[model samples]
Target: MRIGLFVACITDSLYPATARATVRVLERLGHTVVYPAAQTCCGQVHYTSGYRREAASLAGRFADVFSGCELVVTPSASCAAMVRTGYPRLAAREPRAADAPRVLELSEFLVDVAGVTDVGAHFPHRVTYHPTCHALRSLDVGDRPLRLLRAVRGLELAELPAADECCGFGTTFAWKNADTSVAIVADKIRHIGATGADVVCALDDACLTQIDGALSRLRGGVRALHLAEILAAGDPAGDR
Candidate 1:
């Protein structure tokens, strides 16, 4: 399948590895990935922080840039969730000429479009899952990620407590409300620590950053990485 890779601003700048891993995972599964050069921010940061007008304009640009692709896929569930859920709401407020539901998060696009239940990757660690709020609530992706993960060879998936709760990073929420953010993440860290997992994995890179921050600050011995990074390990290109 020919897929359009929607490399959001955060992944392109802060976490390029997630973007590269996304390409690796798609290519490993025999799909062609086309990165639209005009792609920019998903405006999730703006939208979530009460910048509706700016968010709507950015959403239009997002749809316009990737309109040619048969299917649009993004690794950051935060960005994808913004496009899927936030865009529709913003689109309705505007003229609605640019609204399109073809865009999908990596979790949904992989399982739904590619008909790929298994991507043939392996991670032999006791890993825990953290479902970032956007991926779980906005994108509504639960089993989609787990289904692919369960197929990874030698991967011991541990059940994390309160998997559906946010990691306290809703764009600027972490920085704006530092104390509350730290507190929420502290609770999450305790849950993952209880699981005794070597690392915590999730689809959204934003959550990884948030959770990793709290884990590091609290001195918890756990690491966080995007789900694509885990799956891309199976690719012959080598892990990033």
Candidate 2:
């Protein structure tokens, strides 16, 4: 099975390790991974920010790049949501653009497409998962991530308190409504602290950055990790 990795902007720039982990997990499962160098932002920010024309242009670009790939996989749930949902609306006037290639979030691709849950990963850590807004409501990835985590050899999966609550990243909402964003994440941080897990994991880097930053400021000791990173883990000690 050949897979094309859509390393979304945030993941490509700030969380390259997540991209690499994604490749590692897929290759470990015996799938070939291809990276399209022409790939760029999915225009989610532009569309969500109300720049329809610019967003449409980017949507067309995205369609051009990955339309021929066997399958597109991304680590970011929000980006997948944008390509799957947002792109069609943005490219409605352009018939060709509306037929953009199918894209799946990593968890969905692994569970639904590949039909495999246990990828033979080993990670010795007490971990809790924070399902991002796009992953939970937008993408509705459900228990796929948890299923993979539960299969990890040495990982102890702890249930997160108020697990469905948004981490307050909300894409541009984090900056546009700074005070409200901080307040929401403060509550999220408190709930995470109660879990007593060594690490918190999520599908989107945006949410992880939000939760991880808050945890770091207070030296909360709980590290934020991406789902792919955990699934890619082979070391008993794991990557710190």
Candidate 3:
């Protein structure tokens, strides 16, 4: 399958490895991954921030960029949810509205569309997964990520406490509601610490960033890693 890689803004700028790992895993599966340079933000922030017109413009551009691909995959669940759910709400009458159903989160694409869970990955670490709100509620990608993680050769999957709780990174919500965001993230960090996991993995880098910041402030040893990064580890070619 020819898959169009929608490297969301956060993955492109802050977590490029996530994008590379996504490509690595897809290519490992013998699928052609195409990067459309024209692709930008899925208009999620704009849409959530009450800029419907601006969000619609971006959604239109997103559709044009990946219109030719058979499938569109993104590592960030928030971005995938934005394209899948937010785009239609932002511009139902626009041509880009038709592209909503074509977008898939990485785990969804792997487990549902690609029909494969074992991506031939290996990682020797005690890891806990945080289901981003967008992945859990918006995309309903329950257990697909965990399924893939379980299939990894050397990964020790630890169940996170209160796994369904939000990480307090509601995009701009962090800026507008700093105190509440900090308190929520503090609780999240406490749960992560209780797991004694070496790494915290999630489908959204934005959430990971929020968690990582708290970990750094507390001088915690735990590392925040994207799901793609964890899967990208132990590549036979040592490319990752």
For lDDT, the strongest prediction is: 2
Q: What TM-score does prediction 1 earn?
A: 0.93
- Residue-level lDDT tens digits of model 1 in 1-240: 898998867678899888888899899888899998887788888888899998888887876777788788888778877776777788775544155537788888778888886787877778888888877877788788888888878788999998877778778988899999888888899899999998899987777888888788867677888888888876677443
Question: CA lDDT of 9 in candidate 2?
Answer: 91
Once model 2 is optimally superposed onto the true structure by TM-score, how far is the C-alpha of residue 85 displaced, in angstroms?
0.9
Task: Give one digit per residue, the lDDT tens place, for model 3 in 29-145.
Answer: 889998988778888899899988888888888888887887888898998888877776766656666665388889999999889989888888899999999999998998999
TM-score of each: 0.93, 0.96, 0.96
Instruction: Determine the C-alpha RMSD for candidate 2 after optimal superposition of all C-alphas.
Output: 1.5
The Cα local distance difference test for each model comes to 0.81, 0.90, 0.88
Alpha carbon lDDT at 37, candidate 2? 98
Greater-TM-score candidate between 1 and 3: 3
Task: Please identify which of the two predictions, 1 or 3, would achieve the higher lDDT against the true structure.
Answer: 3
Question: How well does candidate 2 match the true structure in TM-score terms?
Answer: 0.96
Better of 1 and 2 by TM-score: 2
Q: Enumerate residue pairs that collide in model 3.
A: none
